[model samples]
Target: MERAMGISHFGAAAAACVFMLAQGARAEEAGPHLAIELNAVAPAETGCLISFMARNGHPAAIERAVFETVLIDRAGQVERLTLFDFGDLPAGRPRVRQFSIPGLACDDLGQILINGTSACEAGTLGEAACAEGLDLSSRTDVELIG
Candidate 1:
């Protein structure tokens, strides 16, 4: 039993290392390159626990967006969930950020738009590629990475 448990832990660790290394290759970042780290993604609940940080490729202190914890009920219904509104983000322009969620194979964020402006937090990260009527507080749909 002891040997089996050790093997399991070792295998898990190895798998995690490999996965992280693999992800290192395909991180779509924008100009100046802000290190994007996913806090936590829960597709099963149609939400994610996200935290922002600034990166300079060599470990520099940076600022990022303040996202509120979006919640999803067991019934799989989406209401207007607000985490942060027009908060600051880290360096560089905004680009696609990957997430992990279960049961959400794929869903369109539909441009996190508002009105008259497509700049959710333009002052900080410059203009982003989102619609003007998109609700950044809502999770349109996400895909489960499993």
Candidate 2:
């Protein structure tokens, strides 16, 4: 009787472990979110050039996405507010967009904030869907926030 109980407990534990692994796999497969990464920053003739790599993990394509972006100075003060239009992001594909801020130096810039979505045009998906599960990352010293 003792040996039978041990085997039964071992089987139940194995089943639970398998179940958890399956759930994790499903979550990875169903990547229902957007990922935005700050690829690079360079100095342009006009000013500071900012490059962003955006990946749409949603099932549908986005016609247009406009984000309310705020540039923060090194002292953590708000520098400027502007609208960055990321046009036509295909589903599961990555897109790169560059913006040049006139009269701003790359070193002086501290952080970039995605205040909110100014506009999002996705078929059957509302504007709020653009920011749904939005993830931000940066490769440079400047921070990227949502």
Candidate 3:
């Protein structure tokens, strides 16, 4: 009877170890591996345009990518813009996207805040998993805030 009790405890311990290791593996597979570089360029006409680049650094493919951006001016005025949704980005590839802001000029911009990301997914990283892993940078004078 004592021998049977020892075997039961050993089995339980082994099961717990396996469960922990499995969880760790899953976590390792899920993470954000995307980098963003943005620049505000002045057009010949009169307004400003935003140039964006999205690069995937992970081995797995990114299925969907979307971001919510808030543009703040020097006078504390705010304008919200939704970046173009880039779908299906292969690993190690960089995608370029650009858009024009009708009347906002490059100098008028004060700060750009990335409010949130949605529809972000990768092979192992689930939907919206890449939001926290983004490394954002800008070439313009305006500050890129979060």
lDDT of 1 by residue, 1-146 (tens): 99999999999999999999777665422223333323233334554433222233312222333334343343455433444332443334443444333343233221221123322443433333222122233233332110
The regions of model 1 sitting more than 4 angstroms off are 1-23, 28-71, 92-119, 123-125, 129-146
Candidate achieving the largest TM-score: 2
lDDT of prediction 2 = 0.92
lDDT of 3 by residue, 1-146 (tens): 99999999999999999999999896577554677778555663657777777788777888887777788887767865656566777788888877677777778788887778756766576664467667789887777767
Query: What TM-score does model 3 achieve against the real structure?
Result: 0.66
Which candidate should be chosen as best, given lDDT against the real structure?
2
Candidate lDDT (C-alpha), each: 0.37, 0.92, 0.75
RMSD of 1: 11.9
Q: Please give the clash total of every predicted structure, in order.
A: 16, 0, 0
Root-mean-square deviation of Cα positions for candidate 2 versus the true structure, in angstroms: 5.7
Score every model by TM-score.
0.28, 0.80, 0.66
Which is better, 1 or 3, measured by TM-score? 3
Q: How would you encode candidate 2's per-residue C-alpha lDDT over 1-146 as one tens digit per residue?
A: 99999999999999999999999997787567778999999999989999999998888899999999999999999999999998989999999999999999999999999999999998876776689888899999999998
- RMSD of every candidate to native, in Å, equals 11.9, 5.7, 11.6
lDDT agreement of model 3 with the native: 0.75
* Residue 35, candidate 3: C-alpha displacement in angstroms: 0.6
Candidate 2 at residue 134, lDDT?
A: 88
